[model samples]
Target chain A: MIKLNSNLMIHQYFCLMIRYLKKQNFWFVFTPYFWLVLFFFIPLALIFKISISVSEWGMPPYRDLFSLSEEGFKIDSTLSNYLFIFSDPFYIRSYLNSLSLAFTSTILCLVIGYPIAFYVAKSHANIRIILLVLLIIPFWTSFLLRVYAWKVLLQGSGIINSILIHLGFITEPISMLHNHYAVILGVVYTYLPFMILPLYGYLVKFDLNLIDAANDLGAKPVNTFLKVILPLSLPGIIAGSMLVFIPVVGEFVIPEMLGGSDKLYFGKIIWDEFFVNRDWPVASALAMSGIVILVFPIVIFQLMYAKYNFKNE
Target chain B: MQNTILRMNKLFFKIFTLTIGFSFLYFPILTLIAYSFNDNKRVMVWKGFSFRWYKELFQNEQILEAFYTSIKIASLSATFATIMGVMIGFSLTRISKIPARPFFIFLSSSPLVMPEIILGLSLLLFFISSNHIIGFPSSKGQLTVLISHITFSVAFVAVIIQSRLSSYDKNIEEAAQDLGTIPNMIFWKITAPVILPSIISGWLLAFTLSLDDLVVASFTTGPGANTLPIVVFSKVRLGLSPEVNALSAIIMLIVVLAAISVYFINRSHIKK
Candidate 1:
C-alpha cells in the first residue's frame, strides 16, 4: 500500500510541474512584451497620429483623429502640420542649423578624441586603467554642471577673461556667454567622451603585430596607419560618430543655456511649438521629422556594417 | 639617428595629446570646484576661500527636497527597470518560441538610441491620452516621471543583462538540469549568481540615468515632482549660483568615491 501511494505522488508531481512550466513560458514572454508594447511602441505610434491630426485651439490643442459624431464614422486627419513645417523658412533654417551643428561638433570631437583614445589604448596596462577611470569620472558627473562650469569660465569677469587681461592679450573683457560658438563649444565638450569611449574600445582590442608587419613589409608609418589601422577602426569611428551625431542634432539644454536668439535649432523649435506656442501637432511633426532624419542613416550604416563584417570574416 | 629622432617625435606627440586631452576634460570641473569656495556671491569673482555656499546649500529646503525626490524616484525606477530587464533578457536569450521576436527586439532596442526629447515628448503625450481614455494616474507627478524613467532605462539594463547572459557558458545550466535540478532551481541557484554583477551594474546605470535626466523629467513632471537637474537648471538657466557650485562639488566627490569603491571591489573579485 505504501509503495503504490509513493508512485501516485510522483506522477501527480510531474503533472503539476509540466503545467507550471507551460504557464511560466507564456507569462515570462508576455509580461515584458506587454509592458513595452503598451508603454514604448504605443507612445511612438501616438506621435504619428498626433502629427497628422488637425490643429485647433483647445485643451488638448488638436482635433481628435477619429471621433464619433452625428456623421457616422468620421476620420479627421490632415498633413497640414508637416506641410506647414516644410513651408516655413523658420523651420527649414532650424533643421539646417541643427544638422550643421551636429556635423561640426561630430567632426571636432573626432579630431580631438581620436588621438586621445589611441594613446590611452596604447598606454601601459596600469596607466591605462587609471586614465580610463579619470575619463569616466567627468562623464559620470552631472552634465548640466559641466556646461555651467563653461558658462562661468566664459563670463565677462570669469577666469578666462581675467587671465587673458592679466597676460595683456586683451585690455577689456569680451562677451562670450551666449553665441553659436559657445553652443558648439558646449556640445563638443560634453560629447567628446561619447566619441572617445567607443574608439578606445576598438583600438584596445587591435593587435600591434599588424603595424609591425606593415613596417617590416617596407610600408611607411602614414601608409600603415591609413591602410591598416584606419580601415580596421572604421567601425569604431562610425560608432563614435553615431553616438555624437544623433543626440547633438536634437540637443536642447546646451543650446538653451549657451546659445543666443540669433540661432535656433530643431530641439528648441519642437520645445517652443509645444510649450510656448501650444501647437501639439506641429511639435509632433517636428519630432517625427527628427526621428526620420536620424534613424534612416543609422539603419543604412548598420546594414553596411553587418555586410562589411561578413565579407571581412 | 633616424630611429632616435622618430622615437622622440612619437613620445612628444603622445605627451602633447594626453596633456591637451586631460586638461580639456578636467579644467572646467576643477574650475567649478575651486570657485565653490569663493566668498563672493558672483561665481566668477574669487574674493577668498570660505564654506559659505556649502553651508547655504545644506539649509536650503527647496534643493534638499528636490534631492530627496530625485533619490526616491531613481531607486524605485532602477529597481523596477532591473526586474523587467532581467525578464526580457532571460526570455530573449533562453526561450526559443517567443511570439514576434523581431518586434520584441525592436521595442527593447530602439529606446537605447532614441533622442531624449522625443522620448520625453512621446511619453508626455502617452500619459495625457491614457488619462483621458482610462481616467488613470489622475495627475502627472513623481509617478509619471518614474514610469518614463523605467520605460527608457529598461532597454539599458536589458542590454547589459543580455550581453552577460550570452557570454557565459550554458553547459553548467544543462548539467544542473540533467542532475535532477528543476528549471526554476537552476535559474535561481546558477544563472542568478552568474549574472548578479551585471544586474547590480545595470541597476546602478539606471539609477544614474534617472538622476541625471533633465529633459524627460521636465516633460513628465508636474507639481511637487521637481528633480535635482530641473531645480539646478532653473537656478542656473538665466544666471549662475554659488550654492549650485557647492552642490556640484559635493556631487563630484560622491561620484568619485563611489567609483573608487566599485573599482576596488572589481579588482578584489579579479584577484579571487
Candidate 2:
C-alpha cells in the first residue's frame, strides 16, 4: 500500500534479514542442536570410533583409528575387543549379574513403591502435597548420603544389628553389609522415589469413581484394583520399571559401597577396565555393548509401542 | 453393624500399610540424623550426646573446599544448562519446522536415561581426543567437569521446560499478535513471563543434579577439581566417619528447606 522504490527494496530486504536473525524460533532450534551435536552425539561417535581401535600401551592407551602404514591407505581397526569381551567368563558373568540385579531390584521397587504411591495418591488433596513434598525432600538430599544411610544400617556393628541384638532376634550380628542383598537394598532405597513419582503421576489423575462403581457392582477390593486400577496404571508401571532397571544395570557406586565380591556389574567392569586395567579399548567396547544390551531393547519396545498406538489411532 | 465393622477393619489395614511404608522410607533418614549427634569417633558406638563431630566438620578444610567447588560448579553449570535447555524445550513444543527433529529429540532426551558411567567415560575420552587434536582444554579440571555436567543436566532441564511449554496456552500469544504485537515482543513479553516458573524450576533441578553427580564427575575430574560427592564417596568407601554424618545432616536440612520453598512457590503459582 505504501511506496515501492529501489531504496525501499534494499531497506525491506535488510529488515527481513535482521528479523530472521532475531526470531526466537530460529535461535531455539539452532542453539540446542549445535551444542547437543557437538558435545553429546560427537562424543558418543568418538567412543564408537575408539572402541573399534586396537588396544595398545601408550598415552591415550589405544591405537589410532586410521594410520598410514606401508600400505597406501590403512584403516587400523579390530573387532577383537568385542570378541575378547564376549569370550571372557568374568565379563559374561558380570553382564549376567547386572541383569539379575536389575531385575530383582526392579521387582522389589514395584512391590514396595506401588503401595506407597497409591496411598499418597489416595490421600486428601491438602495432605497429598505435604506427603509428596516429604517424598521429594529425601530424593533431593545427597544420593551418596542416602546410600551411606544403608551402610550405617547394615554394618556389622550398625543399627540393624544393634536393634536385633537388643530385641533378642539374634545373638550374633549377621553379616549384612557386604553382600549381594545389601546392594539390592541400597538400589531399592535410593531409586524408590524414581518409581513412586512416576506411578503417582499416573495414579493421581485416575478417576476414583470407577473404583466406587466397581465396588457397587459387587467387585471386591482386590478385584477392583486388578481390573480398574492396574490396567490404567500399566503405562506408569512400565515407565517406572524401565527408569529403575536401566540405571541399576549400569550402577557402580551402590555395589562398591554395599556389595561384596559375591557379584559384579557391567558398570563396575567398565570402571575397572578404564582405571584399574587402563584398557580404553575394552572399556569403550564394554560401554558400546552396554548400549547394545540395554538400550537396544528399550528403543525397540518404544518404536513398536509408538507404531502400535499409531495403528490403533 | 457388620458393614461398619468391615469398614473400620479396612481403614485400619490401609493405615497400617501406609505407616509401614512411610516408616521404611523415613527410617534410614532418621538414623543418619541421630548418628550425627553421636559423640564417639566410632559412628556406630554411642559414647554420649555431644557436638564434637559437628565442631570438627566446621573446621575441616577438605570438606569445606569440596563443598565450595560443588556450589560454584553447580551454579555455573545450571545457568548455562538452563539457557540451552529452554531453547531445546521451546523448539520441541512451540515450533514445528525444526530440521532433524527426531534426532534432536533423541540427543536431548537420551541423557536422562543413559548410565552415568558411560556418559562420563565418553566425555572424558572426547575431551582427551579434543585436547590431543586441538590445543584447547589441555587439562581436565573444573572447566571439563562443568562442560560434562551441563551436557547431561541440559536434558533434565529441557524435560521440565518441555512439559511446561507443551501444556501452555497458545491463544494468549495469538491474541497478542492480533493486537499488532511483533513476534519477538510477544515471545519476550508473554512467553517469557508464562514460562518463568519453569525456567526457575529447571535451573534449580539442574543445580541439584550437578551437585549430586558423583560417578560422572569422578570420571571427568582432575587432581584439583574434587566435588563434594567424590570427596564424600572416597571417605565413606574406606570407612564411616562421624564428621561425614554431621556434614550429611547439614546437607539434608538445606535440601529440605529448598524443596519446601519450591513447593510453596509452585503451589502459589498453580493457585494463581
TM-score of 1: 0.93
The 10-residue segment of model 2 chain A with minimum total lDDT is A304-313
Error of 2 at A137 (Å): 0.8
Query: Candidate 2, which segments miss by more than 4 Å at Cα?
Result: A1-25, A300-313
lDDT of 1 by residue, A1-313 (tens): 9999999988886787567567667677567767788888899899999999999888799999999988888899998999999999999999999999999999999999999999999999878888888888888898899899999989999999999999999999998989999999999999999899989988999998999999999999999999999998888898789888988888999999999998999999998988999889999999999998888756754554334322311
For candidate 2, the share of real interface contacts preserved is 0.68
Query: Considering every candidate listed, which one attains the maximal lDDT?
Result: 1
Number of the top-ranking candidate, with DockQ as the measure = 2
lDDT of 2 by residue, B192-230 (tens): 999999899899889999999999999999978999999
lDDT of 1 by residue, B1-272 (tens): 99999999999999999999999999999999999999999888779999999999999999999999999999999999999999988876776545445556666767767888998999999999999989877999999999999999998898788878877887899999999999989999999999998999999989998999999999999999999999999999999999999999999999899889878877787788
Mind giving the per-residue lDDT tens digits that candidate 2 earns over A1-313? 3556877987876777566557545665678778878888898899999899998888988889888878777898999999999999999999999999999999999999998898889889988998899888878888899999999989889999999999999999999988999999999999999899989988998998999899999998899999999999987888788889888889999999999998888999999999999999999999999988887646743553333222311
Off by over 4 Å in 1: A1-24, A300-313, B96-100
TM-score of 2: 0.93
